[model samples]
Target: MLAKTPFIPDKPILIVCGHFGSGKTCVSVALALALKKSGKNVTLVDLDIVNPYFRAADAAELMKANGINCINPEFANTNVDIPSLGAEIHSVFVNAERDPDSVTILDVGGDSGAAALGRYRQMIERAGYNMLFVASKYRPLTDTASAALENLREIEYYSRLRCTHVVNNSNIGDETTQTYVENALDFGRELSELSGLPEAFTSVVKADFCPALAEKYPDKSFFFIDNTTRKLF
Candidate 1:
């Protein structure tokens, strides 16, 4: 296990946004799990109404089993349309912001889900959440940094919040090797510079490589993903 970083109060809201198939949910889950291990009162909120198949809510039960709070409109009231902003989410946002121990990880939807966030602009802005846009260099349409930045900007405008960081989560399924991870890191660094944002807070590495790579790249930030859980460094 790796040591956890202190959670900043103003950074309570963590918006995970990205284009479709960019692995936003995976990144968000990894982040939430890592924070929970560090003893933070983490809340993983699934706000991705657009893509129903690859939703963060799909792993809600597992997340809750590990003591992390998983909040999703569907979980509270399945009848309510996932795309519609309801009282359940609003209340969660309010309470999460007031509770100092709360670290809300919002797994926002893809481009189509942008409209849903428009309804909660005030809450998001007031929460002072740190937005992280995931950019996968291996993804077909998003291979170019310029296109990825544009997509991120669209999400930012729709969500009414500026993205503070970029996370490079590039991979090719089980075949993802160390070289692929390094390529993502290098691409992310260049993208950050191009977008005038700070360096990527971290890069995601498969769990299989954690044991060996963790010790090798002790200085660089990393997020680990496995069959059962996700963790951070």
Candidate 2:
């Protein structure tokens, strides 16, 4: 096993959003778990009111077992598709903003799903947030840099918030390879140039290959995904 590199959120409110099938929930789940493992007070909020398949609430039980506070929509994990958010989210944000040691991660849904974030624009703007825009080159419509940038714009427009960083989460699930990830490096570089956003990091699922990729590109940061949310499928 490779010695893991920790990914700590600089801002207390860290928002994770991206296009459909970009693995936002997976990244959020992995990140929340990582922060909690590092002894930080972590709260993971499932802000996904769009896609029902890979919701972060799918891992709510796991996160609670790991001592991470979790909040999900009322109809989450059910057959309903309501965009209902509880009043507790406001309290969580208020507390997180005041507590320096606390970190709240929002696993937002895709383009259309980001509309749920618009309601909390004032709260997020007041507390300051670091939004990570995830893009996958392997995904259907977002395979190209131009396509990905367009999707980012839609997400930003819907959320009424801008992305602070870009994360290349390109992978073909368990079939992801070193070569495929290398291709995404080029895609990420182009996307960064186009969007004018600094890269937060790239995510790789295979622990064995992650070390080699990290060594190959010392300038870029890499986070090894532990494949937690895949069980939702």
Candidate 1 structure quality by residue, lDDT tens digits, 1-233: 43353223257777888888777887777778778887778888878777745567768787978898877755333544446544666765776667877788888888657656777778878877787788888988778788788888888788777888887778775678987887676677777888887644554446667556557767666666542323332
- For each candidate, what is the lDDT? 0.71, 0.87
Q: What's the true lDDT of residue 215 in model 2?
A: 88
lDDT (10s digit) by residue, model 2, range 1-233: 32243466787899999997898988888888888878789999999988876688888788988999999999987887877899889977787767888888999988888999999998888877899999999998999999999999999999999999899999998999999999889999999999999888899878879878878999988898766666634
Candidate 2: give the clashing pairs: none
Residue pairs clashing, model 1: none
Runs in model 2 deviating more than 4 A are 1-6
How do the predictions measure up, each by TM-score? 0.85, 0.94
Consecutive 10-residue window with the lowest summed lDDT within model 2: 1-10
